[model samples]
Target: MTTLADIAETQRLAMLSLSQRMADFETHLKASPPGADLTGLHKDFSAFKEHVWGVFSALQRQIAELSRSVDVIEMRHRKKFLLLGGVPESSGEKVPETVASILQSKFGLSDLAPSSLTVCHRLGSASDGHARPILLRCADSKIRDLIWRTKTKLKGSSYVVSEFLTRQRQTAFTTARKLFGVTNVWTMDGVVNVKLPDGKRRRVFSVDEVVALGVEHGKQLDQEAPPESSSNRKSATSPPSIRSRRTIKKK
Candidate 1:
């Protein structure tokens, strides 16, 4: 089984190789005398640089392709799962039963059964101010899709249904919505889709892709640092001036 670490290591090795080649080229350049106008050396260096760039670009492209494939496989495994957010919490609650009830009473999935869920539980601790979202893994993918398609029915209710996206994809979805507006951003089958200003749709899979979308749409995605608090700030005092004591000369 191939892990993300394996892909990362492959890319790292490619980078290392590129760096070594660059160092060799630099050494060659330094070895040449200042007055030596060697046209052959210049040609050789140009060819070397071009070859290095070509190889590096090819390796990077392959890495990106492999990453996309892995992401697709990982996301496919989550097709039967949906995240239920904004559901009120209770003390000593039965998570699966509560999720079933919410689906039936709130989302109008009256036929959804607690037994249909292969796994259902709150995602995180209830200590956070926000309600802990329930992760519902349905036994059937069709039911998950049905629930997802009807998520619009949750409007005005404190509920939201979303796909179980990977961390990279989740970040991209959030960034796309922030940059392009929620009305223009959405996800379908784990792919974060953004509707550009020109009405063309773009799919983003990572934070970098979302940033590229922002650049394409002329949105300033650079985050400005927050103002530092001045409550405990002390005044900047100058260092104490050292007085040069001159010996009094008695004439």
Candidate 2:
């Protein structure tokens, strides 16, 4: 016996409840400092509960619609999942063996993996030198931060990350040109290759550079040592190490 009128009334009530709850949230946010704990206050608000329920209901409806659409597409295609593996036969023309070797040996990519797994590839242009450009395979904030730190530590190198391959490379090349004011900055598709000490090659980028910088910094600290006056140094070098430790323990 649920009529359209009843549904309308229910929706109107939900909207009013949600609005009141949002107003309470806004008031709390205004009163609280940026890092203050407001969990108890949030839980006490009735309006917040209503607002959360409404959001959950809306999400459920959208998910149901998406499920139906996916079912239809799968029925039509006679496939449960879409396949994005392998290069298109049309573009499978002979490429350099070096490119293949680099992808497998350095980047640790499987020969028959899906195209999506590769993320992006940048082809070398005539203007850029022979140095292979870096390829970032992951899409995440942590990875991005790691890469940025690495780039900054690399004394004379730079890097960029973009969700889109075309735009990222173009931006990288442009930025490198401006930063170094030099045209010899390299660009290439996929991974950047560096020669190893044992006559082998490896793929490395800003992420690796950051790690190397951290290790180098640690070594430098060890070599330079610390001034004797420092509490840390005194504790380490003191004749009565146990007494110093006990004093700190008492404190």
- Which candidate tops TM-score? 1
Cα lDDT tens digits for candidate 1, 1-251? 97677877877887788789788878888898888888887788789888878877887788788877878886777666677777788788888888888788866778888998877877644564556667777777787778888877766566777777866687777776667765667788888888898989988898888888778768856653223234211111111111113221211
Q: Model 1, stretches more than 4 Å misplaced?
A: 9-32, 37-44, 89-91, 124-127, 223-251
30-98: candidate 2 lDDT, tens digit per residue:
788888887777666666567677786895566556544543443332211111112222233333333
Tell me each candidate's TM-score: 0.72, 0.18
Which pairs, if any, clash in model 2? 122-188, 122-189
State the weakest 10-residue window (summed lDDT) of model 2. Answer: 238-247
The lDDT for every candidate, in the order shown, is 0.71, 0.36
